[model samples]
Target: MSWWGKVAGGAFGFMLGGPLGALLGAVLGHSLDKGMKGMEGAEELGPGDRERVQTAFFTTVFSVMGRIAKADGQVSKDEIALAETVMREMDLNVEMRNTAINLFNQGKADDFPLDEVLDQFRRECHRRNTLIQMFIEIQIQAAYADGRMDGAEEQSLLHICRRLGVPEFAFRRLEKMIRAERHYAGAGRGRAAPPPSKPTLNDAYAILNVNADATDAEVKKAYRRLMSQHHPDKLVAKGLPEEMMKMATQKTHEIRQAYEQVKSARGI
Candidate 1:
């Protein structure tokens, strides 16, 4: 069966036991219980398992995003727009879009179980660091939607990283890359006129999480590691949702651009 079908068929029967499952059950209502009987023997981490993980990822992403949005006790218009932008980027169909919206709303609820949801999501990822990292990046993007990561949002992000087993240094590196990307993208859009010099060189190094004076071999290693981590096909096989492949694709593009820029500058 298709991933979506698997997710729909087993989401309730399989997930109804957990906090996230309870939220989904509430949102999906009677429909979630319709196929509970047929969802047996679908627990292996094969294709069906991948679908299940992907579904979990999708659900956890928006829900946690909502939680982060509400961390400041007020969800800004920019944050809402960012959620909408993600929906649009994923190009979710009506049913899936509605599901995402519901999940997001559930996340914003005062009683949302952030720790429980993160624990479940971490288990779903099966120790796949790349997937966890990607999850963090998405949250960071949403946190910065209002042009800065507020104090509450930063605290929330730190908690999330700790739950996901991401180191503080790694999170800092990601933050730098995110900031650089926003700057680079803004420049590309002509949002403001450029100064005499471009920020490409510095931004490139930041994207790679390497210092400007890093050795050639170190730069190559970072590039290769990032490429492997963000490779869309690899991530998909490891349970990244098809709908979210765009994120992996864009990440790879940024890494490639950074590597190219570094190579040109260093005469490599």
Candidate 2:
């Protein structure tokens, strides 16, 4: 079973026993019985700390995504569609899909405890900066799903970055990269005409979080650091859920493309 299936099937309450636990109980309903027996021995052996981090990442991601969706006062059809698209992309099974939708709905509630959830997530991450950055990146992707980040959504993103100890400058840089990514992706689909000019040159630098004027050595250093930070094996060892590895993989692809673009442009 996938980690999410195990999470929903296992007696999460026995291990989590916190707001996240309560939330899972409400979301999973009576579906927990299917895998209960399998969990019995594992529970006696004690929950894996990695399991806790995985659960935390899964729970916090969907809930926080819903919160961001509602930041503009009303969740638009586009936003709803975006959520469904993400579910499809993740290839969630029926049970896990329902649970994810419930988590998203819970996040839209007026009483949703954003701060508490973030605090718990931060604790679970245990200062693993790469995981935290990936978390922020996913949130940013959700915010930009509608093709633009509205004022309310931008404010919510900034608030999230502040709470997560992510610098504002870094947040802005990621925002630019996401926008660039969307544009780049869109331009390649069934279009006979090309954009007046490719933005990849500038976007490449943004993706590496470097300046156009940076030296070749500086660019090389930035590329290596980003690649190291996003290495899937390293992140998985540090407790990134298996389901999220795809996103990390995609990130590395983007970084590599960006680096290649920069290297070509500079003849390096």
The model with the greatest lDDT is 1
Candidate 2 wrongly placed segments (more than 4 Å): 12-14, 30-48, 187-198
Q: Write the per-residue lDDT of candidate 2 for residues 3-97, one digit (tens) a residue.
A: 56567557443355456655676677665434343453332333337777778888888899999999999987666766776676566779778
lDDT of each: 0.79, 0.76
Clashing pairs in 2: none
lDDT of 1 at 85: 76
lDDT agreement of model 1 with the native: 0.79
Instruction: Encode model 1's per-residue lDDT on 117-188: one tens digit a residue.
Output: 999788878898888988898899888887788899999999999988899999999988887776555532
